[model samples]
Target chain A: MKTKSTIAIIGSTGNMGSAIAKSLAKGSNRLLLFGREDTKLQTLKNDIHTLNSGADVEAIGCPKDASWEADIVILAVPYAAEAAVAEEIRPYVTQKIVISIANPMNETFDGMVTPADSSAAQELQKLLPDAQVVKAFNTTYAANFAEPVIAGVPADAYVAGDDEKAVQTVTELVQSMGLNPVVAGGLAVSHTLEHMQLLLIQLTVKNNYNWHAGWKILHN
Target chain B: MFSELEKNLRQHITLTTDEFDRVKRYFVPKKLRRKQFMLEASDVCTRMAFVSKGALFSYSTSEKGSINVVQFAFESWWMADLYSFFTEEPSKLYIEALEDSELLLLKADRLQPLLADVPAMETYLRILYQNAYVALQRRLEETIGLTAEQRYLRFMERDGRLLLRVPQHMIASYLGVTPETLSRIRKQVS
Candidate 1:
């Protein structure tokens, strides 16, 4: 049985956010799209409704002075904007599973990027200490998100958080997208996965390879 | 510095006094003289060593053979080329002692059982990796977005303690800047 999860994508107009909204619309009915730009939010809402007629979707502009009442909140904003978003929505996030999809890439086009002591996810976690911040979906490219499979590999998304229940919920969400969800274990493990993404990005650019390559956990 | 590392390790990984003792049995305490190579490039990183005292650095040589310092592991920190250690592949990295050092070394075969016996070690490891990943992401972002001077300022703001211990040349290497560039940035910032 597919459990209906009330979801809100904080930055729905961006490439990854829109892709997530599309994927969720196909699988689940209840979705609320939020974006700073009103036109983008309305456009995404219309697109999701058009694609999945049965999907119960709503679009809202500005999370500030807005009710963030949802089971899950997907933070799809840039890494630089994450702290502000977390602060704005902190009071509204009562008991929601917060998933950060932003990777701390350089704001400029200069090579690899991330902070020295912590990741964007960790920074978000610090800001919203109450919300269960699970790091996932940051590794995969937006172009690969719409596809059923990435390359020959079934896009294995890594989910990591301190809360077991939150992890399970996000795992199910990943599975719903027709992608495998491997629990990489806790928020700290996010570091390894993020570094792996850096490596993947380097490989992709240096080798002139497709962005389809993703990680899969092999079991004996 | 070692105490901070111990506390960080203990917070994430739980070890029974007995398990800690058992794990301690496998670790051969050894000293690394300054400039000593702990692990070399083209070698499989077979050991995960915990620093009980002093500083060490792990770095890789670029195409031009210029050494790029990736990390500096101070006292109580775990140091290794994780990719090489896990995959048993020849490392592009070289690990060396930055100062006179004492480390508790554990071989891979021994580490597996130790982690299995002490599940908290897994938690500790997860935290360690998470912290590393977070730092890497931030560094990458800084590298890309921030000006060279901004990056140096941010680095100092975050790791002021490390600035005192690690030399100017190594700091420059870690920042992906030349020593002269770092000196110039420092002068301008100061």
Candidate 2:
């Protein structure tokens, strides 16, 4: 039996956010789509509901309201908006399973903008200090989020968080999207995932692996 | 001495008493005096060491023959020239103890069999490598992007314990700055 989780996707109008929303719509989860623009939120809500008629979905103009009702909240915004969005929902983010999928990539996408000591997820955690920030899906491209699988194999999404329950919840969410969730060491492991994104980006641009490429842990 | 290694491994995967007993059998216990080399440059790094007590560091020499610190391993930490250990190539790094240290060395030959014998060992090794890899990646970024003062401050913030234990010059080497520069940075920050 699938657990019906109430998930809020902040910045649902964006590519990564919309892709996650589209994937989650297949499940019996209640989706709270939050965006700056009400019309885009409404369109996304309608599109998601159109795909899964049973999905109880809502369009939220206020980001704070989205965090209030969601069991799991995904900050799907760009790196630039991470701090601002986190600040908006800080009051309502207490103990919320917050998933950060943003990579602090520079404008050129060739290098990272985040400082070496801190990761974007860690920065988000610092802003919403009470929220359980789990880093996931940062390694996979936004293009891959629509399906989250490649070449008949599920893409491995590394998840890192300090809280055990939050990590497990995010892991379940990743699995719900038909992707493999790997419990990467801890919240500090977000440092590695962010760097891994840069390496993947470099490889993709240089080798032309495109959106079809996804990482998998081949263990014996 | 084995307690730290056991506790660290148990955090990730639980092992039965008997399994742990067998696991300990594979590691060759070693003791190194302060400044003694566990591994030297140009040798094939056939083994990896787990520090049970005290501290050690691995470093490489520059073209001018000046040493650059690469990594440090204190209690419960693992160290090796991974490329040389895995590929049977000559090591570019030299690993030496900063203080008299106890270590549990695992040779390359025994590693695979140990993993097969105790599946939890593989999980433990995987977690260890993952941590090491992440730390290295972060350090690389810090070296490339951050200022010396920023790097020192960040290191202090993250690992204050290391700040107290590791020598100033070694920490300077890790941060890619001279000892005098690190001193100035420390003073400025303080």
TM-score of each: 0.51, 0.52
Query: For residue B111, what is the lDDT in candidate 1?
Result: 72
Residue B19's C-alpha lDDT in candidate 2? 99
Candidate 1 C-alpha error for residue A69, in Å: 1.8
lDDT string for model 2 (A1-220, tens) is 1224568899899888888888888887778898777777778878887888888787866787777656678999889988888888775665567899988989888778888799998988888775789998888777786767688888899999998867887888789788888999799999989988888888888898866677888999
Cα lDDT, model 2, residue B100:
85
Who wins the TM-score comparison?
Answer: 2
After superposing candidate 2 on the true structure, give the runs of residues whose Cα lies further than 4 Å from its correct spot. A1-3, B1-190
lDDT (C-alpha) at residue B55 in model 2? 88
Give candidate 1's TM-score.
0.51
Please give the lDDT score at residue A66 for candidate 1: 30
Steric clash pairs (candidate 2) = none
lDDT of each: 0.76, 0.82
